[model samples]
Target: MYFIGELEGSSPDLKISLYKWNAKFFVKFETADLEQVYKISEMDVSEAEVRAMVTEEFIQKIIQRFKEMYEDLGELMGDY
Candidate 1:
């Protein structure tokens, strides 16, 4: 199964995709020029832990990194 969501922030808008395979869930972020992916492990952790784990600050950092990488790739590919 797959799901897609949009994440809006002050800097840039991000599109996040979720994929479920074999009971595990994976997340991918997409931008015009690049894609970034991550995996969420199904462990025996509390809901609070999960909430605390993925904070807004962390997500923003991830988005920024992905965007930077994407821009770099575009430069390398002469897509400017």
Candidate 2:
């Protein structure tokens, strides 16, 4: 497993790591305190190529969803 790169200034502290096993690329996204993994079968592309597919816009979308979930949970907890 090799750490390809990371995105800075992300809302939930996102980091990307790549692991190659049996000629398969495993793209791991560490967002906030959660770990999400995506498998990519393309092994002939550069690290930048993988990063391009996982764009900042996509990450922002996930972050927005997470924020909304947390906000809703907080409200529910307050009512308890």
Candidate 3:
């Protein structure tokens, strides 16, 4: 499965591609203007395993941060 996420930063808008295969998730972040990319890997496991790997609080915090970033990007682009 594949999913796309948006990243907002001072530099530029970014699109993140996430691929899930073979019980792992590969996340690739792509910068729209600079044509640069970075990737990180996360192990794929059951919901319980994921919860054990990362705390719910941490996950929620990260999600909130990203959502803010995305919203900021939309505002900067006047597309919100």
Candidate No. with top TM-score: 1
- C-alpha lDDT values of all predictions: 0.60, 0.66, 0.46
Instruction: Please list the Cα RMSD from the true structure of every candidate, rounded to 1 decimal place.
Output: 4.0, 4.0, 10.1
Give the number of the best model, judged by lDDT.
Answer: 2
- Report the number of backbone clashes for model 2: 0
TM-score of 3: 0.33
- 1-80: candidate 1 lDDT, tens digit per residue: 55533333323566655555545455666666667766666564433444445557877888779878977877988954
Deviation (Å) of 4 in candidate 1: 7.8
TM-scores for every predicted model: 0.58, 0.54, 0.33
Local lDDT at 4 for model 1? 34
Worst 10 residues of 1 by lDDT: 3-12
lDDT of 3 by residue, 1-80 (tens): 55533322212444434445545554444444322322334553543343344444644544566677767777988953
Q: Provide the lDDT at 64 for model 3.
A: 64
Q: Give the winner by lDDT: 2 or 3.
A: 2
